[model samples]
Target: MAATGSVALALYYYYVRGETQRGQFVGLWPATILGLAVSLNLEQMKRMLQDFQN
Candidate 1:
């Protein structure tokens, strides 16, 4: 959801506002957000598996 919002905002900045650099900067955020989400989810899954093993 946050990633989607970031994409929309990036588009708006790029096309509507004509701020190419700012849009490009914001465009990079979705990947970072998704990467963080994946990392956190993997950590949570690891904890869950450990709990089950115990």
Candidate 2:
């Protein structure tokens, strides 16, 4: 979702600003989560499209 992506982006920005190892780790979490979410969503979407075609 857009909201999920936005949250991840915000976290990434925050870490960049803080410039610390901990911030870097926390920031990476959101990005990884967002990537997984998007990938899952895409798979679901593909299923929906295939169903519509049949």
Q: What are the lDDT figures for the candidates, one per model?
A: 1.00, 0.70
**Residue pairs of candidate 2 with colliding backbone atoms:** none
Per-prediction backbone clash count: 0, 0
Please tell me which predicted candidate would have the highest lDDT against the true structure. 1
Minimum summed lDDT over a 10-residue window in model 2 is located at 19-28
Per-residue C-alpha lDDT of model 1 across residues 1-54, encoded as one tens digit per residue: 999999999999999999999999999999999999999999999999999999
Off by over 4 Å in 1: none
Error of 2 at 2 (Å): 13
Error of 2 at 53 (Å): 0.4
Candidate 2 residue-wise lDDT, 1-54, digit = tens: 654665566666566566465555555666677788899999999999999999
